[model samples]
Each structure stands twice: as C-alpha cells, then as structure tokens.
Target: MPDNATRVLILGHGAMGRAFETLLSARHDVAVWDRDLVTGVETQPLEAAARGREVVMFALPSNPHDELAARLAPCLATNALCVSIAKGLDARGRTPAQVFAQHFGPRRDWAFLYGPMLARELQAGRPGFAMAASLRPSAGARLQALFAGTALHLDCLDDVHGAAWAAILKNVYVPLIGAADGLALGDNLRGFLVAEATRELAGIVEAMGGRADTAYTLAGLGDLVTTATSASSHHRRLGADLATGDATQLAASGANIRSEGVHTVAMVRAHALFAWERFALFALVCDFLDDPARLQAGLDAYLARRFAAPTGR
Candidate 1:
C-alpha cells in the first residue's frame, strides 16, 4: 500500500457502493461486502471486511443500519472512521449518523457524506460534489485526502446536524414535487412547490436544533433539485403514482426499491417532530399520501392555511 492509501471497507454493494468503489479504488485499497453479490466487487464477511480497515463506508439503506452497526461494532479497529451516505431515517426515526453512533464506541469516529450525488453520474466519472461533515477535526481531513484526485470534490463542513436533517427532509418534500409534475401543473406550480418545500425544510430543521440556513446548502437545495427533477427518481415516481392513482407503476418499478420518503412522511406525521402544522406544504403532502382522492382538498387546505396565516403563527 502507498503511504497515503487508506483501507476502505464498503458495507453495501448497491449502486452507491459501486460508485464509491469506482472513485476511491483509483488511489485507495477497497473491499466490499453485501448479502447479494450482484456487483463484481470482492466480497468478504462482515468481520473480515471491517477489521483493521481505517474507514468503513456504509452505502446501504437506512433501515438496515441497525443490523449493520451491530455486526460491525465488534470488528472495527480502534480509531476507525465510520462514514454514512444514507439520507433517510431508520425505522426508529434516527438518522444514519444516529445509527452508527449506537454501536460504535470511542474506538470509532463518525462522518457523513451528503449532497446531490447521483450514483450513475458518479460511477461514470462525471464531476460531482458532496459535503463531508464531522465534529472530529481529523475525520473530514482523512476523507478529503482519500478522494483528492477523484472527479468528486468533497467539502469539509462542521454542520453535521444541519446537513443531515436537510438531506433527510428533502426526501420528504421531493415526492410533492413529483406529484405536481405528474399532474402536469406546469412550471409555475413546480416553482411554487420548490420554494414552499425549501421554506418548510428550513423551518423544520430549525425546530429540530439545526441551523435554518443550512437548508440552502448542497445537502438541502442541491439534493432537492436533483431528486425532484430527475427522470429516474423513485420518490418523484411515487408522487406521480399517487397523483395519477396508478398502482401498477410502482409495482412495475420493482419491489426491492424502497422509497425513503414514504417512511419519512410516516415518521414526521407520527412523531410531530417539528410542529408540522406550521408546514402547510408538508401537511398537504402527508394528507395527499394518505388518500389520493383528497388531492384537491389538500391543495385547497394548503392555500387557505398559507394565505390565511399572514398574521404569522
């Protein structure tokens, strides 16, 4: 190994994992472990892959973080930097960082990667950007050093909570954009939805102890634009499916595809984490998700709640 090479163990074999492998393997030693070996990356057991690796990157779904953390906790070497790229809430409404924090003790340091990174674009060596955030000073530096020459440029930021919440909140709002797109509401409506969603995201982030302005950063606005407008976005498709009442669309899309926004919608509703009533647009999306037939009513309610409250709640 070169003096600067970092041993990286990728915990999932999904598209994102392959993207990382393609980018990082150019300069670092990479190994991958996934239950399914569809990707051609070298496979190893959890313990074997994780042990002694300087960095363990998790590219799996949020729901699996708990189990992966359990399996990795025992094997990770001291001072291993744990990185999470998941932008969804786990089953318990904990974010990806929260999941790893549970299992990894002082032996593990933590960081998060977030932004408008599309796996296909990244794997193709197209220019991409992301934020690497950590409270620990060295964690971000290590990531920056590892990806020095890659097409992907990583900026180190200290606002881990803000970046994370923004990323997760964007998933919840993109489906609304998709639903509007499916309904053919025109550019005017799309523009309105984007603005409203961004405002609501900032408000919610602030309510949850994160800086409100962070919503305008790459993790928030940049990611929202990518996911909301992309042709291949599953959350947008789900919104369209809901708007058009087309059940078969999602069925045809495949069962393995999990829409993180679906769970996010449920979580925000059940937990009332941010005084959801203040977020008229979010409330409308949740109502629409619950019953597609209420689409018109949801819109009417959103308009009334938004305009009628100029007095400021």
Candidate 2:
C-alpha cells in the first residue's frame, strides 16, 4: 500500500469496477478492463491495460469469474495479484477466491476483497473500509494498499477463504428478507425476520470457518442490512416485485444488475450446505417464489415459528 507507482488493471468495468478505478486512480496507475471495456468504460482493451500493471483485480460478474481467470491467467504479470470483488458463489460451489486459485493459474497470486462497499457510495468518495486476503501474505498486500486511500480504508486478512465465504453467506440471506417486506408484515415481524436470518448467516459463516465475530462486522451483517433494505438494490427490488407477483414482468422492468440472491438461493438449495435451523424457511422461499399458495404458507410458517421457538429453528 505504501507504493504509488503500481499499475492496477481492474477487470469488469461494471458499477463496482468503475467505482474502484475512480477511487484508486489518484493513488495508483489505474485502468478498467471488461468484455465491453472499450465501449462500456470508454477505454482501451484489457490486454492493453495489463501492460506494466503489477496487480489485476477481477470485478466481473459472479458467473464468469472462472472464465476470466482462465482467460487472463496467461497474460497477467508473474508477480501481479488477481483480486476478486465478486461476492456470489461459482458453479463448482466455490467462492471467488477458490475459483481464482483453481483457475487463475501459475503467474499471479490469487486473493479476494470483501465488505459492505456500495458501488454508488464508493463512486462518491464516501469513506468505506474493505478487506483483502490470500494464502500468501506478502503477495496479498500488493493490491491491499492500492485501496488503502483516505476515502477507502482497508484491512489486510490472511484468510481470503473465510472472508469470501462469510461475505456470500450473508449476501445469500438478504433478498429473501426483502421479499418479506413485500409480504406486508408489520415492523415486529420484520425485526424477527432480520434477527433470525442473520443468525442463520452467522451460523453458516462459522460453519464455513469464518469467525462468528465476523458476522457482526461491517463485511457481513452490515452488508446484509444494506442489501436487504436499500431501495437502490436490484436484489431488494427483485424481492419486492416477486412479492407483488408477476416476476417475469418485474425482471423485464428492472436494471441489468443481476439479482444475486436469486441465483444464490437456487445454488444454496442445490448445495444444502448450511444449517437450516433459523434458515429452513429459506428452503421454502426458493420453491415458494414460483407458487403463490406456497408463498402464503411460508408467511404462515413464519408466524407459527415466531411463537414456537424464539431461540431458533
């Protein structure tokens, strides 16, 4: 982080990528690279951006991380660190860091970055903190300080695995709760929903080897609150629309930002990886999205559970 001359190639010029380029530009040599980089970013090609860059941060859509990792693996500088900003799970049920490690290949160090960093806020130069981690400490720090600017605070963790796992576990819970808001539940019920769902998040994170304390930190719980409640989130809006019925029309109306929790919920069910205690309802939530009667049944169960075991499912 102490160095200023490092060239940084930010992959995927989406909202988060642009925000990062703007935030880190003054502190380092920064440029964006996406599939549509030349057009979407109004810039040069990614291969061109990689020239002399010491670090490459992968901010692509969650689904294509592995593809990009494999594509960019050969071109990356031997010493460059490939950082991941994606918070969703991959096809192999791996976190972004795992995908990079397996697919990013020989040249660069693979790492992950995670937090409650809202792209809109970061684009505005709002003060925000994020974490960077990799199995290799020194290699991880190459891009760590690139984001350690005054407006963008940074923390260094050695465990990218735990950090990424916690991030997605929390992200996986946000939208379902947002759908509850559309269910027209009163504040009391919403409060219980958040508390229980987050407890589920914390449990899953710990089960996956993250600190239980991490869930209370800005990266996990804070991210859940923001993604679940913010009017700006496509995920929340998607849930609101789903609750109102007519999901196909809602998708057509919404912005291009993918509904991360929607995809995550499907994958979550396929993996059956988490403790269903407080989160068993989410299993129903997945199916209920397609059936109105089942959706109503979920609400009824929420009420039933509310009085039965406040401790958890």
Candidate 3:
C-alpha cells in the first residue's frame, strides 16, 4: 500500500459497499465483509478484516449498527474512525449516528457520510458529493484523506447530528414526489411538493436539535432531489405505487426494494417525533401510505387547505 493509502474495511457487500469499493480499491487497501457470504469474493473473518484498519465504513442498514458496533469495538485499532452511510432510523427510531454514539461513545471516533450519492452512479465511476460530519474534527479530516482524489468528494462539517437528521428526513418526502408523478399530477405539483417538503424538513431538523439550514445542504435538498427524481429510487417508486393503488407491484417484480422511507414514516408517526399536525405535506404522505384508498381525496384536501382563500375578519 502507498504510505498515504489508508486501510479501510467496508461492512456489507450491498450496492453501496460495492460502490465504495469501486471508488477506493485502486487507491487504498480495501476489504469488504457481509453478513451473508457472496460467491467468488475474497473476504476474511470479521475480526481479521477489521484488525489494523485505519477506517471502518458501516455501509449496512441502520438496524444492524448496534450489533455490529459492539462486535467490532474490540477488533478495531485504537484510533480508527467509523463512518456510516445509512439514511434511516433503526427499529428503535435511533439514527445510525446515535447507535454509534451509544456503542463507541467518546472512546471511538465516528462520523456520518451523506448526500446525493446514488450507488449505481458511484459504481459507474461518476462523481458523488457528501458531507462528512463528526463531532471530532480529526475524524472528518481522516475521512477526507481516505477518499482524497477519488470520485467521492467529501466536505467536512461539525454538525454530525444535523447532517444525520437531514439525510434521514429527506427520504420521508421521496414517496410524496413519486405519488405526484404516479398520479400524473404534472411537474408543477412535483415542484410544489419538493418545496413544501423542504420547509417542513427544516422545521423538523430544528425541533430535533439540529441546524435548520442543514435541511438545505447536500445532506438534505441535494439528496432529496436525487432520490425523489431518480427513476430507480425505491421510496419514490413506493409513492407512485400508492398513488396508482398498486403498492404490491414492485414487490411482485423482485426489485429488492428496502424503502427506508416506509420504515421512517411508521417510526416517526408511532413515536410522534415531530409535530405531525403542523406538517401538512408529510401528514398527507403518511395518510396515503396508511390507506392508499384515500390518496386522491387526501391530495384534494391538502391542496384545498393549502390554497384556501383568506376570509376577512
């Protein structure tokens, strides 16, 4: 390995993991491990792969973070930095960053990498942008060095919580965009949904103790545009399915859709994480998801309330 090249272990062999491998293998000593074995891929045991690594990237879903972090806590180098690319809350409604904080605390440095990084584009050697947010400045610096001169560009920020929340929250609106498209509501409504979602996202971020402006950054608006507009985006497709009343069609097609936004919608509603009543757009999406039959009526009601004429006192 080159002197500047870092030893990086990527947990999970999913699309994002492969994308990261494509972005870094030529420049760094990269090793990948997944819970399930993949045919013809060289991989060592978890402990062996993690040992002596300078950085460990948790490219898995947020749900498995707690278990993985605990298992790897003793195997990592003392100064290794852990980064998560997950954009959803875990089963307990805890972000991956929060799970890392619980397991690693101040002893092990951790960070979140989030933005408009679609796995397919990155795997195709296209450029991707993300914010590397960590409470510790050194963690972000190390992450930047690891991906230097690669297709993945990293901008460092100190607002780890803000970036994490922004990334997760943006997915919540993707289905709404897709629903509009599915309903054949035209580009005008699509644009309106994006703007309204961003406004609600900013407020939710602030309510959750993150910077409101973070909602407009790469982690928020940038990702929202990418996921909401991309034809292959699962959450967007879920919205379209709901709008068309064919929510089961995607599953029948064997697309392996994770649809993180679906889980987020349930988590947010069950936990009352935000003032749902104040977010008409989000509430509308949730109502559609909860009962697809109401989609048309809900959309009509939402627009009616949004555009109602003001009555003079």
Candidate 4:
C-alpha cells in the first residue's frame, strides 16, 4: 500500500504466519498461502504469493520446510529474502537453513529468525527481541533495518550455524527444566539445569562446527529461559506430563501440537553429530525421554559421576 513498503509473502496459515500478516500487512503488501482454504486472511495460490514478493517468510514447522521450499524455489523473485522461523531439525537432521539452501541455492538471500518469540504474545503487541542470523554480514543489519519502527527488536548475527544450532538445541534442553518443575525439584535444580544445559549446548555447537559461545546469546539462552519457565509453553507442559508417567495425560495434550524438542532429541541421538555422552545433562534428558522409567536412576547416576569425578588428579 505504501510506496516504501516491501512485498512480503508468508507461507502457512498458522498462528505465526497470521501474526506476521497482522503486524506487517497494514504497512507492507502481504499475501498468505495455505494448503487449505483459510479464514482471517485472504489466501493466495503458491505461485501468486511468491511472484514479485521481496521477502518470503516461512511460518510453518520444520517438517514442511523442504517440500515447501522446493515448490517455491522456482516461483520466488530473484534475490528475494527467505526467512525461516522453524526451530527444529528435519528428518535428515538438516537445519532450516540447510533445507532452504539445498532448494533455493544462491537464488535467494537467507536468514533465520530465532529467540523468545511466541506468536500469541507477538500478536498481542508485546515487546520482544530476536536474533536474525545470516552468512551474509549485511543480511542481519538489513533485516534489522526492515523492522526499524516495529516493536520487534532484532539483532543480527553472522554465526548462522552457531545461532541455528543454539536455537535448535535449546528446545531440546527446555523440557528438562519443565520435568524438574513437575518433580518439584525447586529453583536450586532449575539454576543447575540452566547452567549445565548452556554448557552442554556450547559443546555440541562447537562439535558441529559452530561457534560455541553463540549458545549464550539470545537465540540459545534467552529462548531456553522462555520455553523452560513459561506455563503456556507446550514443550514445558509436555515435560510435566512426561514426568507424571501418565500416557493418557500426555495424549490429552494433543497429538497435533508441535513439540520441536521431542523430535530434536531423537535427531541428536540418531545423528551422532557430536560426542553426545560427553554432555551429561543433554544425555540425561535424552535417556529420560527414551525411557521415562530411567528418570530417577539416570539423574542420580549423572549427578554422582559429575560430583565424584576427581578434580586435580
């Protein structure tokens, strides 16, 4: 509508996609696409949505990324910026960036949006910050500039791999805090979970050829805190349900709900991208997830070995 407005094509009709449309439509020419006929916003055919848009924002989960990316590759305007909000690994253990790169190649500019952003809070106009990671040094700053007047404050990151991995791994770790909460382990253990999870995340990130320190940034630590502590967080609630060992309770939480962390645990275990055993805290969570009966014994063994390992030997 406005002369300076950038054309934005949003994929998916989910909450995150709708939120982005709600926030940016008034200012920018926005079009949304979904497989089904969606309400609340006008839906466009895939080709029409991708045509001439300056930026294509994917609001779907990671599972659909590769397919949708392949479909949209030929439709996208040359050099259009592609943004991913998915925070988990695909079936091939590929990050969103990797999926898009495989499909879009050098035809599109790529960026990942990650941090403590909940679509509901964002739609309600709550102030929030996120990291925009890109391999191109100017991509982050350019993205930051795009939201210059918005409530969403964005910081750019050059370590795209580090930021992406940090964001992904935080989801895997957040549920541990929730399980601790379900067990009523108190703030003391909560503090330990935070410290140990961050440390383990850094090690995994480094092993995967990413900057280990990125784990301390907003994409990693900031998001971990939000997902771990928030009562509204599905992953947190899932953890609490897991701790109770009630299959019906877990089932009642809904099969359709996207718990990125659940899939991430399996991916980490299957991929062997890192020395997963070295990160005892992460391994503890994985072992517990794989066999809930091991929650108590696994935790005890982890703590015992951690404390008893002789220092300065």
lDDT of 4 by residue, 1-313 (tens): 7788988888887888888887787788888887763453435567776889888888877877887888888877677888988888888888887787688775457898888888888889987679998887666776786676766789888788888899988988777788888889789988888988998898888888889888988899999988898889988877777887854545563323346787787776788667778788888888877777677788788779878957785
- Candidate 2 lDDT over 56-91, as tens digits, reads 877775667777777666777677777877877766
lDDT of each: 0.80, 0.68, 0.85, 0.81
Q: Which has the better TM-score: candidate 1, or candidate 4?
A: 4
TM-score rank, highest first? Answer: 3, 4, 1, 2
Q: What would the per-residue lDDT of candidate 1 be over residues 181-223, giving only the tens digit for each residue?
A: 8888788888888888888889888888788988888888888
Off by over 4 Å in 4: 37-43, 249-257, 309-313
Tens-place lDDT digits, model 3, residues 1-313: 6877888899988899999999899989998887753363445677878889988998888877888898888878789999999988877888888888888888778999999889999988889999998999999888888888888898888888888988988887898889889889899988888998898899888888989998988899889999999999888888888778786854553312367777787788778877877778888878877787787798889889889999899
Q: Assess the local accuracy of residue 310 in candidate 4 as a C-alpha lDDT between 0 and 100.
A: 78
Measured against the true structure, the TM-scores of the candidates, in listed sequence, are: 0.90, 0.83, 0.93, 0.92
Query: Which of the two candidates, 1 or 3, achieves a greater lDDT against the reference?
Result: 3
Candidate 1: segments with Cα more than 4 A from true spot = 37-43, 105-107, 249-257, 308-313
The residue ranges of model 3 lying beyond 4 angstroms of the native Cα positions read 37-44, 249-257
Measured over all alpha carbons after superposition, the RMSD of each candidate to the real structure, in angstroms, is 3.2, 4.0, 2.6, 2.8
What TM-score, to 2 decimals, does candidate 4 have? 0.92
